[model samples]
Target: MGWSWPANPALWPLARELVKATETRQAAKSPLPHERETVAEIRHKTEASNGDNVDRTSAYLTFFRKHPEVHWALLAHLVSRNAGWSMTDLRGELLPRLLPANVQQDYFSFLERGNWLIFHDAYPQLLLYEESVKRQTTLFHLLPELHVSVFMQAVWNHFWKTGDSKLLTVGLIMNEQHYLETHMMSDETYQTTVVKTLPFALQEVLRLNLILFPYRAEGQEDGALRLAGAPVFHFASLAERIELGKRLYSLLFTSLRLREGAIQWASDKPHTGSRKDFWPHLFHDLRETAPGKAHQKKLGGCQLLPGANRLYSPALRHVWKQVRHEAPKAADWYPATKGVMRQLLLSREQPASFCAEEAYCQALEKIERAVLAKGKLFGS
Candidate 1:
């Protein structure tokens, strides 16, 4: 298992599905018109600035317009590969400079107004947190009548139009312990980028992870936000551990969907060549980048992460690593112990996606394949 996912009975299905995900591969897209020009401009600036130059605002727009999730991957790489850095970089460091002048203020306004989505567990109109998304496109019914940023609204509108609210799953946003009072990333850059990116479904997931970084910090004994116990962590004994397992699954699901989705979208968008063809290709950037020392420290001795985006990768992996994979001590780490992950497998009748729905289906089907392969629900 060197440099690979662990061998836990609970994780094999996820591991198997993940393998299948890469098997078909997240298909890439053709390059958009401005990519080559943008790359040349970026390279010229990087060279001129001694390799630390930023992409031009025009190039930024075209790049994101072609691959909105690419920035999420980049940000993930930075956080996971480097240590001590936080989401604050998105605002103080990245956005103001990365975005054009005309939209900066509007972008800031989205941050100020995004308190609606970040702080509330549920609006009166929205459905309470449920495991299933009901196969509906828009989470508009999931939101309250409030002033949100232009960027968040686009995601809202897309889900409204498409009804694929898996991107807006409730556990990420609705759990007060997890989200309410969470420091919303509120970065103006993301607001700007989200508007131009290819898939509108992913913005909420990116936003959720940006804010989630504070708690994920390994050594932040006194960080601004601390979820020593999150989601169902405070529940009574056995019940609490059972719930924690579910929360872990939610994190895994969101990250993989976005990762696999990026793979699918990457091929169609124009930017580079085949996996080995270009200097910096999608998977090269997404998967090939080694975990940074800082991230390794946070992961401690964990074998792998939960999703394509390293930042949003499972913190539970760190938790599992904390006890060094000892089965007897599982209850010491969390209220629930062995065989818990089997309880959280993606259901067969889960809601359908309006687009890239097959990615969700294909990924889940791997679990069925896992079941077939192992001859049991717990595919060890």
Candidate 2:
């Protein structure tokens, strides 16, 4: 069944109570020493897992396994895997040919910062939820002490009462994207150096903004993997990003084939921050050819073209060092209740098919052609 914002008038009073309670807690005196200790422990855990992409990815998966009702953890794990793939792609064979070293580094910083910031904000909330389950009570009022957004305090409270995983997932998707809009998307440095740059513009034009969820169907000979996901569009718009995330959630959970298959694949395969995680036939963590060597086509509509060398998609540890990020700037982007309701309503759209393997392959070909053209023109 398609999920929607609960229309029961009785629930409205509950939501109002949650908001008032959150505000009261926020206005309360400093946390006692015991509360301080708990906050510190969660912070330490969040930092430990947030050290790098692999650590963060595994943390999300582990949390999801333990608390499957928190659908956002699983979704975050899959998307975090994609973020790692993108980080490696910057240092991969094709992109180096297309982008200068400094430009590549800058792009990595941009992606890494977003990944880090989101984990910083979201992991504590997950841990708090775990604590709540353990204590058999809702402890989301402590969210403010952890620097979590007030938006989530209400949603978590609502989920505690209703066990509505879909609503909580949607709430999280909205919260994180809105969080990014404040911290990363609007920053002048990122705007001037990353988002507004030609390379960033080219990413959209080349259809490189894809988020793939891969799964191997049952009884497929040779364990052929299939990908299902929609490309992100109009990323500069917060609404578009929210919509894209909702679509991904729908695609991941609504289809039984995809949900079961993706879960199995994630279980069987540990992420190594390489495209090889999903399509080892095309991508390798090690270099397959000498630098500047002419290469044959490697893909044809998601299948390998005959005799093509596996493209170099290095693991994250090989290509990049772990980043030590400054604490994210504090701010809340929560909208009025009316705006929240509107977003929730909009999140209830029909599930759209994200089987775009052919399109993804086409994008890869475009990048390959561009690289070849550059080599020919510059004689590098």
Candidate 3:
């Protein structure tokens, strides 16, 4: 991949200066009293909001409202909401029938760990940025104390100087995915137990890799909601994940209906880790049918089939206990400047407008058929 300077010619020099400053700061031994206090306060806030899916989701939205220039906050909020939905799905109606108990537990652990680790690494950075904006000075030097990647230190400094939101967003997308590359994706336990399993392969075949953004389209009635997002292919590849994040960011911000409608929906609806948050007619937080009963297909191209029963998509608190996470194994996965610069080029490409209704409906019907087939074969 060819790496190039940011579009603004001035940024090349600014990047060099920030990189040098970060290197110099990393050699320091201790912080001043006020700096120590600032670190403590930010750490406290990060922990307070890091409690669970609900807390983290709200924290991201709150931060985005306060500091809209940091585009990654809203992106994180929406993506984290999806993570919560995935967590609940392990214990929801269809997955329980398809996957055994032990497999479900492992899958939950896998999803939860990735969710926890990303927040752990990213939240402190957001707090530091907040503090920087208040004090009118860059505070990213303290990032080393919080164990954030050096890549972010430079990116934050550049953003503070230039106010380039797009570059900053892509920078975050690159940093966090690489952060997971070592801690979660490359780990022996998750690799053997989750990623390499037959069930994992089934995720691709069933179209579960789609990251959906629900919104009410223009000229549509208030009661109607629709889905728009690109399917994530080759998720195991770091390059692919970065591309997926950029494509999603583009889709969300570039389209008028998606941007306004999604913000309105998220603002009005509190996330409870249920599909019902967006499509209440198709999904319910409570079980409406007995377990092992054949589920009637409720979906017809993203709208419910007429008079169909709602699917049981349980809330996070109802299905799974709050998880206590072990500290992430320490490693800085930042590549050289040449490699990081290559990711910036992806932000320049405009992704075509995506509508996920067809893909999502197909996946739902496939799961419904699987659940019915398993019920008949085992007579459960």
For candidate 2, lDDT tens digit of each residue in 280-332? 88888999888877655566766667777788999899989999999975776
On residues 224-337, what C-alpha lDDT tens digit does candidate 3 reach at each position? Answer: 888888887877888999989999898888887788888777887888999889777778899987776766566666666787778889999888888887787666776443
In terms of TM-score, which candidate is stronger, 1 or 3?
A: 3
Looking at candidate 3, the ten consecutive residues that score lowest on lDDT are 1-10
Quote the positional error of residue 240 for candidate 3 in Å.
0.8
Q: Report lDDT (Cα) of residue 54, candidate 3.
A: 77
Candidate 2, residue 35: how far the Cα is off, in Å: 1.7
> How large an RMSD does model 2 have?
3.3
Off by over 4 Å in 2: 1-14, 294-297, 335-338, 346-348
Q: Which one wins by lDDT: 1 or 2?
A: 2
How many residue pairs of model 3 clash at the backbone?
Answer: 0
Instruction: Tell me the lDDT of model 2 at 212.
Output: 91
TM-scores for the candidates: 0.20, 0.93, 0.93
lDDT of 2 at 33: 88
Of the two candidates 2 and 3, the one with more favorable TM-score, higher being better, is 2
